[model samples]
Target: MGNKPSFGETDLPCPQPRQFPMLLWLLLLLILPPGRDQSGVTPKAFLLLNPPWSTNFHKDEVTLTCRDSLSPAQGDIYWYYNENLLNKKSEEIQIHKTGYYKCKTQRSSLSDPVHVDFSFDKLILQAPHSVFEGDEVVLRCQAREEAKEKRFYRNEIQIQSNFTLQSVSMNNDKYHCTALVRGFWTWNKEISKHLMIQVQELFSPPMLIASPSSPTEGSPVTLKCETWLPPQRSHIQLQFCFFREDKALGKCWSSSPELKLPTVWSEDAESYWCQAESVTPPIRKRSLRSQLYVQRIPVSDVTLEIQPPEGQLTEGENLLLICSVAKGTGTVTFSWHREGTVRSLGRKTQRSLSAVLQILTVKESDAGRYYCAADNIHGPILSKLIRVTLRIPVSRPVFTLTSPRMQAMVGDVVELHCESQRGSPPILYRFYHENVTLGSSSVPSGRAVFKFSLTADHSGNYSCEADNSLGVQRSDRVILSVTVPVSHPLFTFSPAVPQAVAGDVLELRCEAQRGSPPILYWFYYKNVTLGSREAPFGGGASFNLTLMAEHSGNFSCGADNGLGIQHSEMVILSIIGPPSNKTTLITEGVTAGLLSILGLAVTAALVCHFRTQRNSERLSTTGTPSYSPREFKEPSRTSNTNPQEPLDPVEPQPVYNNVNPGDSDLVYSEIWSTQHTNENSANSPRKHWEDKEPTVIYSDLKKAYPDDSTEQASIVDSDLEDAVENYENVPCVLSALDR
Candidate 1:
């Protein structure tokens, strides 16, 4: 409150001409917030001091100020220090002691207290934020002016005779300054707080490390900056950047310790480094160069090549095999193997990525699948299996004869099984009889069977030959005896080539030639069993049929020995009666109608026969015959391969028949007779027509018999022969022809 020129003063000193007090004051007034007191005048309360806010043991002058926006003063002010009240009208107060001071008014709230540090404390040391190696570092100490001496210490080491702020060409250290006062038996010294100067190794060489240490092409890698500063400067904020030798990479400045790379290509295998920089002082350090060598892709597309590379491996021959890479990168190990082996036949580890395997002599065991493998750290790849085969001449073959009986006989199926013991697969076996090649068969395992019906011609020397790629070997000859069955029985009547009268001595002879000794003969009259006779020696037998109406039927005989039976041709014998008055029984009307129907039926049958023969010839010439059923009402047949399942028999492809009413429509009476007449009938047109494709029509016979009648009936439906089966009808046919 007193005007003692205190440090906290209210009045301002006169401004120099360069300051222009009036303009400066007006500018200050314009900038301050408008504050009006209760007296209707703009007023503000503030404090200013001379020699700043503190005094060093009262060595400097003190002043204070309380300025207002409108005028220096318009209201009464109050001042307080250390809670000591001064004048209520005074606006400023100052004291040279470490204490709180403030100003207040009735309209204005109390201002914040300002504490001035005026303790007897004395030492001060200054250091810069950024310091470099060998740079001048300044350490200052300030204490009471009356102190006899001042000293400085770095890291607790004393430095004598330094009174003013100290300077040295050193960095990165801690220093403390102090003043010693000689007080005649008392000691008082001012010590400064420790001041540390951070020295940056901004020029220290940095090192880089590739994270994962070893990298491969096409895989990602991380480059890290491995560097450090002095322990004292470890806490300083820094940033890092990466570069590919000279080119900057992504985000040159990164707060992260390391930079992540997406991928590395072959071209990325080059030198790289990093730079570390201090943020505050802007110091940068370059890192040591590092090389990144990326490994390329592994081996691919491997193959094995044969040395000779023609035909196949042969027995007793040396073989050379090579396993090589078609395309790949980097080192690889090559290996070879047989099909059924786990261990490699040959293996080599080389940068060339190829290997060779050799066999001194190829044997049957080596005639198998072989392959090669290309292996590396990446994975193993295999080539396709190569098939090697060895060929050797076939050895002498052994012949086997398979027959149902010890002596091959007619009607017996004989099989000659042929095989070679040692030979490559698919050896052909050919059967020969008396130097004549019967047939040839190929067997993969050098085995086959030739089956044929035994005949007298087959009863001779039999042999077989086995052959392969190399050569053929024949088996020695072996005799084969075939027993012939009885030939067709020769049946004859006593009166040869003549009709028999009712009283003629009729004798029938049945004989067989070329049959084994001892044969039994059976005589049939119109398929009726008459009698059987046996000859102790292979010869003829006889049967007697009295010349009567009952004996006037077909006569045939069969001879049977151990071999199968053979039947003779039927013999016809008709009795001619003298013209006389004899009563005959026949339906006039029925007979005429039946005869007309028979004629029509015969004509249709003949027309169908002719058409079928032409169609069959055309079909045979074309080699294509189509077959389709006439009805779809039946259930569809499913296809099956099982032998037990009955096969669907093919239907005859119908051909339209054309016949003139009077030409080529004749049906001879003898053709319908039960008796077999002329020898040329064996090759007769009737028989030939029966063998051709038939005309399938909607006939009543089909409906009458149905498919359920006989076993496995063909599409044509077997003819019943009902008329000729009744031998009595033969007389009627013969009589009609005679008429």
Candidate 2:
């Protein structure tokens, strides 16, 4: 304010003229932030040449460097050729190649203009000429200059870089070159070369094969897998896999070219293929498909059976059998067999769907177990077993008689029978006796009968039997008997010459020597029965009858044994009457007379015989003396009164010499006595002849009385002697009658 004196007038402080505001303004300005320059820190600039490098000149080195405006310092550098990466050091890189190139620094700065001029005699990329699809190949970049390091790159990627004397590898392509020093410049000459690679095909995979080119249906088959490779590559290790359609069969790794599977069935057959792969890299495939065919085997069911249903079979009957098959195809073989035997009855083959067998006519041996089998290629198959059996029946029989006495006499008969029980049909029966077969007959059902007439020879035991297919049976024994009858009888009589007198009896007898039983007999004379009697045992019968005129003629007898009557032979009998009455008187009076007469006659006869004998003796001895005078007297009777009569009387009577002297004497005495009586009578009376013989009569009277009496007595004695003789002859007469 001191200076403030001037304050009012303008130059006085020219105001310190706005010094008044300058203070404020200068202070404000000092407190405000500093202002910055608009342009950045000195910008780093670089240049990249196109197609950066070439190796056209011999022993040429390509260098590429990056220059920066900043101080020279070490930094990471990158190089590129086209879009590929390159190796670098210190913001620089070295290369020997023909390629596009570029570079950068690690300081976040751009390099100076990049130069790609590097001359090489040639550019080369190391890669395989041929490789599999997935094989690995490498490309390397190198320089001809011996002292220069080499870099490797591919497709803009950085690879390692070797020292000047080392080699490097580059698997991918892209590159650039650079110098190790900073800011080293190269001309902008660039050249590019491309690497070439090729890929080749792998070995085709293996093929699969099957055996039995074509197989029958249902038959077994085999399959095989095989592969082929180049002769040089055949030893290469490879893995093989086999497939059928989508299915994997199996895997095999071996030097051999083939694989095999045995006995494949139908289901295993299909299209088949194979593959081969190297152990290291790419896998390769090849395949072959083949159509497969499978064939079918024949099949069948066989059976055996019997006919006529069920039942036991008979021997000699017909039998039937059959064999058959149900299902089969193609040719089938059939055979028949018996169980437990290795042999077959028969065999046959047929293409037909069905088969059969038949058998007929059976025997006992035909029965057995039977079976059948069928086959094609498959096998022989067996059927169920069947069984058979057999049977038989019986025959006929015969009968005979054995008992009740073999021989029968009169009325008798025999009985016989035959039978057959067990036979099929028509049985014959026969009967026999005494080894003679009688007759035969047929019996359809059972039995037969026979009757025989009895005979004497039928006497023996007989047997019968029957037979058929079954056997024979015999019958018991049988027998027979017979009978006979009686015949006529005979009779005879004895003394049949004349009549049988009184006191005599005639005998008549009847006999039957041959007859059967109790015989009744009767004796008859002239049809009258003397007596009725029975000779029970059949001997002769006798009848006695006093001789009578009425009982005398035709005597006979009859015999009967109750069977029939038999008459005996006829006989004749004669009867005579006793001596007449007159004869009786002459012979003898009743009783005493007859006796006396007989005695007297005997005495007289004796006296006469003695006198005769005496006389004869006296004549010889006493000479004529003492003869009875009556004996010497001779004829006293008349005799016609003549000399001749005397002479006739006088004639000596001749004596019978055969007569005894006693007999002669008796005779002479009788005659002399009669003569004396006659002489006396003749003299006394010459009256009647009857009277004239008075003396004779007187002599005759004596002679007559005595002679008559004697005669009677002799006759009586004779009769008695005859009766005794008759009595003795009676037995003889009876015996003759019996004969």
Candidate 3:
């Protein structure tokens, strides 16, 4: 013990290897910067109470230590009470006053608040100042002196002496403790005051904020996560994240408080929110959901379309106008206008890209240029201009027919004119006869004319039609009549024989081939009119004339109708006297031999006696025989016969009938006798011959033979005396010889 060194000179033991490392770490913390840890995260500042008591009597003392992730030597501590700063700079503080207390470090955030209650009461119940969910809690009863047999109760129920809770949370249940104390002479019971505990939130629920609440399409947008931590837990690191509906927008967990979007679209309008969470403690919170809506683009590329496509408008038709835009949305307004109109023709408001306006029964006044406009809160856009025109249809036409004469004759020209009251230009006219197309003509304006020569086939109904491509119009029908003229006529005389007696009857007839009704026929003899007759219906006409001496000249007939007159060839006629019977001689074998000769001689002597007596009378009367009837007049009928032809027959007695030899020659005979009385030179034999003069018979003969020429040779005799004298020169000798 004497050899031991003085107290100040004693040696100390060296530290262990594990303990040396811990000491080295503490040294490094004291020299490093404040707040930030090894991971570059700033830790929150906090305060801790010494002895860990909640409530204390008046004038009681408590110690508060401002703590952070950094060592105390690295940063100074700050203190606050009731949101007021304290002047102290030490890491530890002691106070006897009761109030809300908080603390922070120079390089850290503020800590959570703590309530310290300083009461004047004798007995009180004690518990932790700041309580959180899932934390261990302890309850105690205290008084001015020591107590025994203490008991505690929650709300009104008794609890064990340990007075402990596992995973405690906030509550308003009253907690009290009762204990027995030794007072003056007897043991007294003391009861502590009731207390209630409040639980603090880890961090306020997160709030999401959007930068441009109402955004347009194709523009930028920003989102932020807003939250706050308790002052006591400010050093806790929190991570941020954003989501749309239930899907994450970008990184699931990010340290940034704000999330950025390059562009937003119409499809991006949906529910959105953000989340904030502590990194170590796993305290997570979500913000309230927000809806983001994007506006649509403005109207553009306006256009107008027509319904017919061809743009052809006709009278009494419907017109349609369609206005539209290539890209637009929401409510839209459309307007239609004409070129010269002050007001819009039509207007429509709807949620579609196109609109239509219909005009029923289009007319001529609707023709003009047109356009359309569209708007959707933006300026109006116009479409290209279009023009419309109208056309008119044809109207009923008028047809007329004109001719040169009142009564249309064959070969007359007829004119047809067609016209319409209302129609477009370049009209076509067609003329029809009896519903058959005659001809067609085209004219630019006014009426059309077509002329055609009249014919028998053109005597029917006529109509005309006009067309201008819209429709065809026809006119009422007109009737036509045609007339024909008469042709040459034929004349004929009927008797079937060349010769006829003075009392014979004859017929003359005239006819035409083709003529109108009521034809008049005239009969002529010797170039003089005999009589006239008319055929009512259009055939031949005939006249009857008794044969007379004046009717022996040439005969002809003519036919006359309204059109013209036509004449026929002339025909010769003859009138002759009846035949007489007397004693005659027969030659050709002389069959009546003796009787014929004796009769002939007797007849000759009588003829000689009369001739001698007549000759003596002629000598007494200047030697010329004048054979004349005292009151005889010349016959009015003149013979048209050959003047060289003798009045007597070449045969002793020739026949006057049966004379048709395919030739036109004819024969006839006439006889006349007269008696005279004279007193000078009277002779008996001359008187017998004069008596034999016997009614001097005269015969005119015109003969035609079977072998005669076919040429029609006419013989005309003007003198009646020459024919009688030629007959007297022949015959007295032949007469006496035959007797």
RMSD of each: 32.7, 44.1, 30.6
Stretches off by above 4 angstroms in model 1 are 1-121, 132-138, 143-149, 154-174, 180-189, 198-301, 308-320, 324-333, 340-342, 349-369, 376-380, 387-739
1-739: candidate 2 lDDT, tens digit per residue: 0011111111111222323343443344334432212222222323322223222344445455554334253455555454345554555555555544444444323322222333432333333332333344444454332323344444544456531211122122244432222123532222234432322333434455666766654344455544433222334466666566777664555433445554443444567665555554434455566777655456556777666556266556666556666765446778888777898877888655445555555555666788888886678777888876654333325454533554344446556777654554455565666557877666666677776776545656665665443444566656543333456778866554546776576666678877655677888867877787777765777777677656657878888866677887786666766778866876665677667656645544444455455557668897884522112222334555555443333322311111123423222112211122235544522233344321211111111122446543443454333322211111112112111
Q: How do all models score by TM-score?
A: 0.25, 0.23, 0.36
Where's the lowest-lDDT run of ten residues in candidate 2? Answer: 1-10
**How well does model 2 score by local distance difference test?**
0.49
Q: Pick the candidate with the highest TM-score.
A: 3
lDDT of 3 by residue, 583-628 (tens): 2334333667766767655654544455456557767988775542
Question: Per-residue alpha-carbon lDDT of model 1 for 535-616, expressed as tens digits?
Answer: 8777999988666656676889999987688999998888765333331333466678788867855554544454445448
Ranking of models by lDDT: 3, 1, 2
Better of 2 and 3 by lDDT: 3
Model 2: CA > 4 A from native: 1-121, 130-138, 142-192, 209-234, 250-256, 280-291, 295-739
lDDT of each: 0.63, 0.49, 0.70
- Model number with the top lDDT: 3
State the weakest 10-residue window (summed lDDT) of model 3: 1-10
